[model samples]
Target chain A: MAEAKPIAGTRPLAPKPMSPHLSIYRFQINMILSIMHRVTGITNYFGSLILAIWIASAATSEQAFNTVSSYLATPLGLVILIGFTWSVMHHMLGGIRHFVWDVGWGFSKPAVKFLSWATLFGSLTLTAIIWGYALSHWGIR
Target chain B: MPTTTYRTELKKVRGLGSAIGGPGTDHFWAQRLTAVSNLFVVAFLVYTGLTLAGAPLGEVKAFFGHPFNAIASILVVISTAIHMRLGMQVPVEEYMPHGLKVPFLFLNTFFVIVIAVVGVLSILKLFLGN
Candidate 1:
């Protein structure tokens, strides 16, 4: 087939704009925070599964409940619980950030930075307070 | 001579079509709806976890047996299951290889259903057994 020539008097079409690639951007807090939101979100999937298992074990029988509870009381289990708590807290804050953006707020550069940092520190503080309360009240430590 | 185009204005505004030409809008709203509900449900979950920490089996059962607690537990399971399934679909769609993508998406939905069913049933058993 012969190549079709452009109409002699027609202006050439401009190239379409391409979406920016992730590798092209410099590192920023918001980038990491955005990725962390997805990571923590995925982590919570397993955390919810464990929660289901815990409830199922309790419904099974006293012996089964005791076995699950005892395992949860162990050091490794405590570590897992703490990690889950942190993930939940972090993800919750991230969700709130997304909610704020969804409502057409917090899109400015400074606002984005503030929200990202707040999510990180706020989650840590919340986790610490929760574990502190648990340690003092429940004698977990 | 006037140049002509056949695409609708809405399609033009939407730019690129949705992935796989499916109900992307429904998925978007469903995810946000579940996210909104999960925000509250998760708080109740944390509260339950704190209160039930290291409690004896009888006490634990009694707590779950309470009407409000039982209902709240079921809601938490269902909301989180839906949210996680929708959330996981993003990663699966983006990262999974072409051959594995469809299978993983199906498995993602299947896994969430199993979780939600087992969780709701267990809570119901405890609620009724009380």
Candidate 2:
């Protein structure tokens, strides 16, 4: 390999102590679940806002109510609704995981893994069941 | 280990090396309380929503006009909104840059409060037959 050359007007980088986090720690299931919890939480924030808007519009007038409802009938609206539903399910499971921790159990290594996996699979199963009903009955509406 | 020390065992151990009364303890408990409440509220809201979907404007209003549905809806809005604020505050405090942290915290709180206020007002209107 050829020797490296320094860029013009650039000083050499200094070695310094850094905090340990993502860069240092090995990946774990709980770590991923932790991130998923935060992501789904942010999703729920927006989902709740949309829900609030929907209700507020209903309160305003029938026309406003219809407008919001009709938008929810659209393809894009359907996609958002589905995604939001899944987000809620996922975050709810995350909350349950925290509750279990609070109850003074699920701290053993195996138990932790079991709870994490349950949270992942349970959210997906519940979301599928809900959308299953929606799709079967409404057929894209 | 040191009985010779002036402090008693109780005094030595009191509020030492624990987060019991430190900052964020109340926030932590509040989050847990809301989380538990939200489980019930969200269930009720989802059930009401499934029944109300594609419902006509008058029917939607009437459904909400029912006291049970109306109170449940209001509770959902207030509890979930407060929960959202509390949850989001953690990430803002953790991940936001130092200079922007306070601003982001204020914005997060204000946003939740505004949405919640509007939601409660809407629920009240429907409940009161306004």
Candidate 3:
């Protein structure tokens, strides 16, 4: 065997530590809250789409508009509208949380948990308040 | 190196800066556009709803065929459909697994496109005085 010379220019390689995998941990409150945020966001998106269609239909003519409005004014339709309204407010609050996060606040462990609860309780509370107002404004409709 | 930058002081840094570097521009601009479009839509819708106050079916139909009504309706539909696609896309990216991501994304886009086309055409057919 031929003798090999050691190179002067050599660097040591540190064995990289393997971080624990995400799956190793059980499901968490923050994870569920994040998922809900996305779910509400999607719902609100579709709700807005429906709103667009309603407006377009209304803009077209009185008959077309009435067809859309009367359909929307029904009991089942109102239920869907209420669900959509709640989703909108919920998603809006969640969005503000995200925006706050974007600006670099509410990321400490305790703060994160606090924000999670805030997002949840705040969304639900706003949703309830809006629905309560809605019912009063258009009660028995 | 000592922390000369003020950003280093925060114990937990939010990854918001990346938004500006990558898809941030597209998302921000699109959101602004959609918001403006939707405001007009809301306004028109509320107005039309009020106009329908005690109005008969015949009057309603004629109102749709009205020029301002048709133009505004079409514009709102176009902006809304585009907005819907953009809004839902982020959620799909966030939640769906890698294996199912591509397919679901396609489906999402396809679904929105179909709804938008169908919706706009429906409104047009109703208002264009066939």
Candidate 4:
């Protein structure tokens, strides 16, 4: 074996630690919260498109408006409507969290966890409350 | 004589033509500003939507005919369209490969414009009874 010489005034190679991707990291609240934020955002785009369609239908004619509304009142349509409602609520709460982080606060470990949980549960709670009010007053059975 | 430290020549050429540049912070600010505005506009939108859902056609038209509801609906559509465009632009720019990114960016802009136009026109038609 040949002998190797050490170089002068040179630093030794150091292994840089790569941040873990999705698989390696332990499951955390913020992970799901962040992913759901993006999911809800994308979903909201389609929901907004539907909303525009509904508005346009209303503007077209009375029969057109009733046609759209009748379909939306069906079971499958209600499911889609509820899903979109939840997405909007979740995305809005998640957006508020992002805004707080943008202002340079809520980066602490506890704060992050708190905000994530709050977003998740707050959205669900608000959605339920709104739907409850909706069902009670609107007689949507 | 001592030379002056001012770069008047550089200042004159800055932001003059194709070589123009900016800090590009306005995009960030605009996104955040629209997001904030959307918070309120979206709430109003939900309230109005829920109230009008499955109602009689004339009732729905009368509801949207109100100036407050009409203005709020317009604001919601405009703010949300801008916010949606900016939001989608980020993912398309960051995650998509180079070739795909360009097409997606163009699509994003077109989609937002279409949504905004349709939404605004719909609301206006109701408000104007035309």
Candidate 5:
């Protein structure tokens, strides 16, 4: 037996026409920067969580606090710490970009391009400076 | 400039100007939500910090021993978890494929819930003598 079909059928089962295809539309600059803002924000939040835990643990007792501090003493944990610090810096600068946008500037073609570029460059620069300071204080002789 | 054209282009990308929009699911809105929540969390933390400053372990426990601090700590945990979920949701949506994306979304949700429960419970127990 043949299967049931919808009411709209053409002569001898011709394929229905699709409207049209629109291609050659690549993603824009702002989209990528927007994505980065979200990524770093997530990392930064979890980083804050670790900080909170460390604070609570410290409040509990020196023994409890020492466990976390000792974990922080390791190289991998320090890498995580630095990665989170970078995430915080990156998200902070990304936030300033949006703050300017909120005040109704930097949405234009040229201005947006500059602002997007600046977010990346500024985040990298700030992360570098802070990590440099952190390492000097924490790194060995 | 010609950027007004992009507005129309965006509309055309969707089949219709349907009632079901993204429901403020964009990165910008999520960031704004999280930013505001973070401010509140920080304020609460600061207030709690001051109250706990120079407090001994028993006093610290007693402070959070109350119903209000228990509620506030729960709020801090829950808010931070939600903010993290929203923030990470944007990243996965932007960068992941459908197959990989679904699990990450679930993972994000689960991670948030677990942290909120465990973190809040641990804090409450510290105060409540449980």
Candidate 6:
């Protein structure tokens, strides 16, 4: 069979479809929450590495364990640890939000806005309570 | 009646389903499965963290020496590693340029393996009194 070709100079010249640009849209609560979800997820990657190191130090020797413990006692380490706690909480809540959506619920605008705000406040509240209990009960090493 | 179409019955069906084959639901299902498992395991992890917060090395060792704690610790490590790798791949696939995407994805897998191995081994060493 002979293949047919378009006549010369007769093909359509419509522009290709382009993706929506980020800067063109006004920022909203959901946008911040979504970006935060990604940010905290990446943060948890490093946090997991730190956790591995903490466990490895304990397994190595008491000296090794104390070395990590003392470092964690430092203000900077405490800040990082606190930040990691918050990040984990935030990401976990965000994951739950995603799961809720996956199950085909919470697509309504009000539900979405409520969930986003709830995730933010909920994470902060959990982080505070955890740290508060830890500090009051354990007293930093 | 004369036929007007040239495509074979097979050709018409080809490329109609998931490009990755099977039900094409592997990634979707795996991601959600890990996500669900992670919710439980990670709660255990946080509890472990809280209990061990300022614990000495001996205490820490004793804690994991318990069978349940040791098993839960391993579960947390494995589940988190799988979930993180799957989650991270989304950003790498979406934002990374073609030149860097493949390498990033490979590195993501490699990194997750390292995390899981190191975490589980450490817990085992402590649990075993090594």
Highest-lDDT candidate = 6
Docking class of 3: incorrect
DockQ of 6: 0.46
Residue-level lDDT tens digits of model 2 in A1-141: 223343466443334334676988887798899889999999999787788889899899988988998899899998998889888988999899989999898999999899899999999898788777766656544
TM-score of the second chain, each candidate in turn, equals: 0.83, 0.84, 0.73, 0.80, 0.65, 0.84
Worst 10 residues of 6 chain B by lDDT: B1-10
- Listed per model, the TM-scores of chain A against the true chain A are 0.83, 0.79, 0.74, 0.83, 0.75, 0.86
Q: Estimated TM-score per prediction? A: 0.85, 0.83, 0.56, 0.83, 0.55, 0.86
Kindly report which residue stretches of model 4 are placed more than 4 angstroms away from their true locations once superposed: A1-19, B1-24
Tens digit per residue, CA lDDT, model 6, B1-130: 2534444344355846443554437777887898889889988988998899889988999999999999999999988898898889889988998789999999999999998999999999999999
Against the reference, the lDDT scores of all candidates come to: 0.87, 0.84, 0.67, 0.84, 0.67, 0.87
* Candidate with maximal TM-score: 6
Candidate with maximal DockQ: 6
TM-score value, chain A, candidate 1: 0.83
| lDDT tens digits, residue span A52-107, model 3 | 56646654666776787778778888788778866755655666676678779988
Better of 3 and 4 by lDDT: 4
Off by more than 4 A, model 1:
A1-20, B1-16, B19-22
- State the lDDT of candidate 4 residue by residue for B1-130, as single tens digits: 2543233333445735323344246567778899899999989988986797657878878988999999999999999999999888777877898679999999999999999999999999999988
Whose lDDT is higher: candidate 2's or candidate 6's? 6
What are the per-residue Cα lDDT tens digits for candidate 1 across B5-107? 4444455668766644557877888899998999899999988988888788787878878999999999999899989999999999999988899999999
Q: Model 6: per-residue lDDT, tens digit, A67-120?
A: 998899788988999999999999999989999998899999999999999999
CA shift at A69, candidate 2, in angstroms?
1.2
lDDT of 3 by residue, B27-63 (tens): 8778657756665774575456446534555665577
Q: How far in Å is the alpha carbon of A119 misplaced in model 2?
A: 0.8
